[model samples]
Target chain A: MKYRNPHIPEGINVTKRHPLKELLILLGGALLLIVALSWVFAEFGGGLARLIPFEYEQALVPDALLSSDADSELDVYLTQLSERLQKHMAIPEEIAIKVHFSGDDVFNAFATLGGNVLLYRGLVEQLPHENALSMLLAHEIAHVVHRDPIVGVGRGVGIQIVLSTMLGNPDLNVLGNAGLYTQLYFNRDMERAADAAALGAVHGLYGHVGGAKALFEVIKAERDRMGDGELPAMFSSHPLDQQRLDAIEEMARDNAWAGSGAITPLPAAFADWLKTAALRTESGRNTGNTH
Target chain B: MIELGIFLALLTLGYGFGQYAERRHYRSIIEREKRLNALPAIAARFPPTEPQHHQALVIGSTVISVDYFKRFLAALRNLFGGRVTAYESLLDRARRESSLRMKQQAETLGAEMVFNVKYETASISKGRGNTIGSIEVLAYGTALIRPQAADTDR
Candidate 1:
């Protein structure tokens, strides 16, 4: 009897291809097209929006429309800080300062469009050293000097609309998708510019730049305390890698500011004041880790 | 008109899915708020003084959902190595809506300052295959009651 293998009777064995791969290929192509179109529209549409002064003016949202006062002491403190910043930065008398305190204990701070500087109370307490405060404030001031907030918001909204049109949607929720935000993350170029500006401000105010590194160390320590997953997205937003930290240190070393001992004391009564004031104005106190 | 209707139908489907994802996201935020609001206040280094004002503070938020179905579909295409086809369209929509939500809320509240803002997100649906995830967003800030006199100072 002819020994014919039953299993070998089939034609050529073809490797099975997963359906998922094909689907991904299709989806990827669609996404690429969407992105390409969005980029094109944003480039042109933004320019058009700029030319349409009436529409731009119409988009000018009033400050009164989006603010509410919380009976918190931090609000008052921000008012004072804003005034101080305005004078220190030579912010013209005409430009209004919008200061607000966040209810986080992350020892963080940021500048937003239209001269909005948000400082977390946690950062204030953690950076008991005046040099750190100066460093932090000066850093945000650098952002303001660059008018990053306005430029950033304008670009963000413009790009968002273009993408929305391609996506068949209306809004771009920066808060939801971390990846999308990452794409818009300030490039290293912007960070470098901000760093240079911040250094200038720090040298002018504190006579040193090592303080900026100290601030980063404080942030790292705070992150350590918070444990993993508890840290806010803000920490990742600006990013603080060793390279960036080293850049600041290098500037300080070059500027002869490395040995500028103790850039002013942390004030005589700050501790006592924080004890009482923190109790009255702490918003996220209950969480134990409110960042 | 028929073409317009067809386009509208597709738009509505996209919106429905989007909203479903968003609702899931919002529910998570509400849960987070409960926890955050429950936490005790911690002291900052230099706390600001409590303001004495009469004003309404408003904070707005937007939620977006990119259901599991799409993600899974993309993942399958990529051989399930977790490298899915990019969803720029979905992501872009989310970013815009969320930002707009925050802006509108701030404007509506007549707030001169909106502080202590936070963002939270969560997956509305669990598992994969036809199942979708929802993302909820919140943009909240304290509105102040600033006097008319404060406006004139500017």
Candidate 2:
């Protein structure tokens, strides 16, 4: 009979094979691949970031200053809000949190480039409390801090400028019409960053961040009452629902503000002012429309 | 008077340009409609609603298929309203373009009709000032081939 050798190695196969060396080799290979990919992408990916196509030749002057046509008293209130924001945030002073009024039926607010807050008179009137207003303002300001608009614009590199020229601006009028596209154009990453900044700012300033959620609820309720033809501008820009609400709720819970009181509707005085102003605008609009 | 002559000359010139632009826009719209009508041949068949049994036309993001219908209304409003003419042309263009795209998508999906269709118009600009520019019209709808129950039963 042939000598049958035991089906076992005399020396252990594991001793000569070092796991550390193997891991290093694998990691080195991955790193090389990543670097090579990045290099290739860097060279070829020039304007590919701009997913949308727009015309650049028909460019028009972009307005630096927001149209200021509101009452002086409202202007004063906005000034105070800006001061408060300045003190609360560690961001630069140049980024003033001023309010620009939108004469529309929809209740909404937004942050423009830098720190300017565009507040719709209709939306501001719906705010139940000072904290609610602060929270909204802070949220928009947070968008400014995170440079969301800049990044969003950058991502739409080729088409954004052209769109900007054609659309004039992503203001109440434009956004009011296009909801989903605008949201996607803004990109989800920018939105997430703004959400984080807004939540953080609201907590830091008011010691309670629940106002963001409350604001949405109020908006939804108000929207339901108004019924059709007028969806809140926020819905178009910051599409909200259960998931978004839950995300904010989680953030608020995780960073529960130590001392934020229950946010009530605006103080009677401010409410009165807003109501009076709205009446004026509406009456003016009716008269103008009739004419 | 020379002034009256000048006014007539200016009016004629303005009318000529306006007519030219309008004719051009109309031709573009017609071409778009034609392309959209032929969409079914090129697109993947998609159900109008969810579930395999339902028949629906699928709409893609084409200049012919989907867009805001508001442009026509807005333009009409411009005829008797404020300085809104500035927005009228752009809105109309966006609307027509988007609708064409959506129609193409739907037709491609072999959809006979799209119901509960919503129109959306967005301004993707960096306000009045900023170097970068952007604008886009996106229209989408549930594609349906229709009569899913009858077809499925067959």
Candidate 3:
């Protein structure tokens, strides 16, 4: 009787060999798909995002930010400012800009979904005059006019879906990092467009461009205090401070507008409120040991 | 630019070390497998009819970790939803190594053959976010110990 080995098959090769050409082809195909998808999203994402209901966009904001006291002084001030600014610009009636004032001390303001704009107390307190504040507000309003926030969100979602579908679902950490990078890249271009439009809007309102330059100077001073390193221009979402000042001056010269004019001071009540707000923030930070 | 440089450096390191480790492991596995071929473990239900010997259980286990290059390849393969060939070699090496160890144990006991061989495999270390880090393979069998002529005469 003869014994046969069941595990070892005759004339069978167990080792697997993947040719280099096949791997190269796979990589090339994946790269092509990524590029094509990115271009498609860049071209059409804003139009699709605009189709989303205004109510839904508003709902995306946190409830805490929306639930402010009905007639707070800050609210009244912001409402009047937005209305005054809207009167000067050819704003579409369908898109009503709503302003929200946050007590937080972060030196930043942002335009968000639903034509909403946030004004941080820290940045508001830093402005030298009402005209400077108007320049900053105009920049944010331009962002809303262009529907940048929703467009950005739309682009982010589109990219995420494409990436996940192509490569399966990646870890949350990777997805988060990728989303941030994409947002920053999109924001760089959007910011520049907003800055140019806001220059025109501010010029229409004040007949001068000094406020824009002054606002950038304030930001530059803040950056200098923080000892911020020189980040590459391409990687930054906002233009470099010097570049923004230069652009404003060049635009003013080309448009034959006076770059300097009489600056209006903040109203007495608004100025008083700003002082109290700063004090409150200072005390809060001290108590929290955040210094 | 600095970040891109760092990422490329890490990839190069992973590729170099992974290839070296894989080649060394395959060499060891093939050499041991060839030496243990004559005493192959089998899944036969019954021992040989001519056998008048002692039988005892023998077991062997081994754990193998994945190299970084294999892990990177597996991650990319995960996107396309297909066979992860990078993991294929890792599992093959673990199974062969465990079986070789089992055969060597049987040889030490002066066993003629092993019967009813069974293999068990399990994932040991799970990598970050759905990747496999290491795997363990265990091989077991009943070794048929043949009686020596001098001992039978006594």
Q: Candidate 1 on B1-154: residue-level lDDT in tens?
A: 3443554465456546754764575465445434333221211222234555444434445555554334444433443244333344344345435544554454544444434444455445545433454656554444443556456545
Question: RMSD (Cα, Å) of candidate 2?
Answer: 27.2
Please report the interface RMSD of model 1 to 1 decimal. Answer: 21.9
> Lowest summed-lDDT stretch of 10 residues in model 1 chain A?
A2-11
Chain B of candidate 3 vs. true chain B, TM: 0.85
TM-score of model number 3 = 0.74
User: What's the best-to-worst order under DockQ?
Assistant: 3, 1, 2
For model 3 chain A, give the 10-residue run with minimal summed lDDT.
A169-178
* TM-score versus the correct structure, for each prediction: 0.48, 0.42, 0.74
Angstrom error of the Cα, residue B74, model 1: value is 9.4
The positional error of residue A3 in candidate 3, measured at the CA in angstroms, is 8.4
- Candidate 1 wrongly placed segments (more than 4 Å): A1-21, A34-106, A169-183, A187-192, A229-235, A253-259, A282-291, B1-154
Q: What share of the true interface contacts does each candidate keep?
A: 0.04, 0.00, 0.04
TM-score of chain A of each: 0.64, 0.59, 0.76
Query: Model 1: how far is A173 from its true place, Å?
Result: 11
Top candidate on TM-score is: 3
lDDT of each: 0.51, 0.51, 0.71
Best by lDDT: 3
The DockQ of predicted model 1 stands at: 0.02
Model 1 Cα shift for residue B91 (angstroms): 31
Question: Compared with the true structure, what per-residue lDDT tens digits does model 3 show for residues B1-154?
Answer: 5654555575567778876887898888777777777775888878787758688899989998876556656665555667667677777777878888898999888777788999999787545545647779999999877778325634
